[model samples]
Target chain A: EAGVVQSPRYKIIEKKQPVAFWCNPISGHNTLYWYLQNLGQGPELLIRYENEEAVDDSQLPKDRFSAERLKGVDSTLKIQPAELGDSAVYLCASSRTGIKEQFFGPGTRLTVL
Target chain B: AQSVTQLDSHVSVSEGTPVLLRCNYSSSYSPSLFWYVQHPNKGLQLLLKYTSAATLVKGINGFEAEFKKSETSFHLTKPSAHMSDAAEYFCVVSPSSGNTGKLIFGQGTTLQVKP
Candidate 1:
């Protein structure tokens, strides 16, 4: 079984620039999640998706961060006019259903210069 | 709301030594607890999980966690440490609803092992 898959293992962007990250969850998984991991810290949940519906996204910075899980199989997280503090590893994970064990993908390490 | 706390920021152990990582959680309802490991540049991997099913849960990589309802703790342990076990470990909790299925992670504990 293929685990979750993410693109752009690493990314470098200038401050105030817009950046996007993509994720393709495991087959038949109905729950998808996006998390941000700062250096030396554990991951923090940014958003969660049940199929195409975003059920929880309170932690996401609404002013600059946006995410979509269209088609219910893949997801995209976008950050507009990014800041230096936005630099962190963007991790994506998926599970069979709510609260079940999740499989993660190689995260995208974003470096905002 | 659900939250977790990793007791140690870092732990060092020699090979063959017992491994222990402490974790405490808070949740109003019965929450699911989990332990995950992350090697540098890699994503989080499930080491073990403790649902309401059993207090003693074993997971991959020769790891195990005991859920103590009285203490509200789920600490990961191994009989012996290996150099490969050096990584960042996180304790996580998920609410039965709301953040349902969404994990709230601790600050993380770095495990260092020496041969």
Candidate 2:
């Protein structure tokens, strides 16, 4: 089975610009998550989705970031007026319902200059 | 709140020597724990996990970890290290309060294998 997939493996944008990343979860999976990994740090959760509903998004920076999982299959995360500190690796993961194990995708490396 | 701590920021060992990466956690109740590996420019990969099952869990690439509830520790180890084992490893914890699978991750440890 194919693992979670993310698009724009790498992105570079200037500060105050807008950027967006896409993700496609594994087939038959019901849970999806987005994480941010700064250099030298572990991945931190940004948002989580069960089907098309966002169940947990307490960590997301709502003022400049927004995410949506349309059709319960694919997802998109957008950041407007991106700041320098927003540069990090954005990871996507998926899991079956009630399961604790998650499969991850090659992240999008975002560079905000 | 649940949290995880990786004791070391970096660990270096010979290619044929044993490997150990320490981790500790804090949770209100029993928790599900995991160890994941990330090579340079690569995505995170599951190494092993502990969810109130056996204390000792074996994972890919000859890696293993023992969950010690008494000590609140889960340390990853390998009998013999390989050059490919050089990478960053993260310790994670999922709260038992819910099955949402949301995780808290540690700062991570970088492993270096010398030839």
Candidate 3:
């Protein structure tokens, strides 16, 4: 089975510009998650989706960050007018419901200048 | 609240020598723990997990971890280190009582294997 897939392995943009990252979870996986990883730190959960419903998004920055999982298979995370502090690796992961193990994608490394 | 802490930010080991990565966890209830390895420009890979099973859990690529409840520790160990073992490793914890399967990760430990 193919693992989780993410587009644009790396991205560079100036501050105050809008950026978006895409992710396709593994087949038959019902749980999808988005995480942010700063340099030298482990990934932190930003949002979680369960088949089109965002069940957990307490960590997401609602002011500028937005995410959507339309069909429950693919997800898009968007950052509007991003700040320099927004520069980090955005990771997408998926797993079966109630399963503890999560499969991660290659991640989109965003560099904001 | 559940959290994990890696004792070392970086560890260097010579090839063919033993490898040890220490991790400590804090949780209110029984916790599910995991070790994941991430190569440069690569996604994280699961190394091993402990879920109230046997104290010693073996995983892929000749790695293992012992879960000590008394110590609140789950340390990864390798009998022999290989050049390919150089990577960043994370210790993670999951709340046993939650159905969301959310994971809390440590800062991470970078392993440097010297040949």
Candidate 4:
């Protein structure tokens, strides 16, 4: 089975520019997640999607970051007016259900210059 | 609130030597635990998991982690280290509270293997 798929494996943007990351999860998966990982650190959950509904997104930065899982199969995470501190790896993961194991994508490495 | 802690930020060992990565967790009631490995420039892979099923859980690539409830610890260990074992290891926790789905990750521990 194919693992989670993400586009634009690497991205470079200016401090005030807008950046978006895309994710396509495995088939029949009902749960999708977005996570941020800084250098030398583990991934921290940013948002979670159960079908087309966002059940948990308290960790997401409401001020500058926004995410959506349209149709419940794919997702997009966007950061507007990016900051240098936003430089990190953004990982997308999915699972068959809320209780199953998650499979992660290769992650998009965002470098805010 | 639940959290996980990886005791070591970095661990160095010689090839063919034993490898150990310490992890401890704090959770209310029963919890599900996991160990994942991430190679450089790669994504995370499930190593093993403890869901109150087995105290001693074996995982892919000859990796294993023991869940100690009394000590609230789950440490990853391997009999012998290989060069390929050099990577980042993360201890993960999932609360058993209802159907609320989330995985809390500990600060990753980098593993370095020397010949």
TM-scores for all candidates: the values are: 0.96, 0.98, 0.99, 0.98
| Range of the 10 consecutive residues with the lowest summed lDDT in candidate 3 chain A | A66-75
Please give the DockQ score of every candidate, comma-separated.
Answer: 0.75, 0.90, 0.93, 0.80
Candidates 1 and 4 compared: the better one by lDDT is 4
Arranged by DockQ, best first: 3, 2, 4, 1
Checking candidate 2 for backbone clashes, the offending pairs are none
- In the range A1-89, model 4's lDDT, one tens digit per residue, is 88899989999988999999999999998999999999989999999999999999999999999999889999999999899999999
In candidate 3, which residue pairs get closer than 3 Å at backbone N, Cα or C atoms, i.e. clash?
Answer: none
Candidate 2's TM-score reads 0.98
Tens digit of per-residue lDDT, candidate 1, span B16-97: 8999999999999888888999998888898988778989999987899999999999999999999999999999897765
Residue A54 in candidate 1 has what lDDT?
Answer: 94
Q: State which candidate, 1 or 2, has the greater DockQ.
A: 2
All candidates in order of lDDT, best leading? 3, 2, 4, 1
**iRMS for all predictions?**
1.7, 0.7, 0.5, 1.1
Model 2, range B1-115, lDDT digits (tens) per residue?
8999999999999999999999999999999999999999888999999989899999998999999999999999999999999999999999877787888899999999999
DockQ of 1: 0.75
Quote model 4's iRMS.
Answer: 1.1
**Every model's TM-score on chain B:** 0.96, 0.98, 0.99, 0.98
lDDT measured at residue A40 in model 4 versus the true structure, 0 to 100? 88
Q: What TM-score does candidate 3 get on C-alpha atoms?
A: 0.99
lDDT of 3 by residue, A16-86 (tens): 99999999999999999999999999999999999999999999999999999998999999999899999
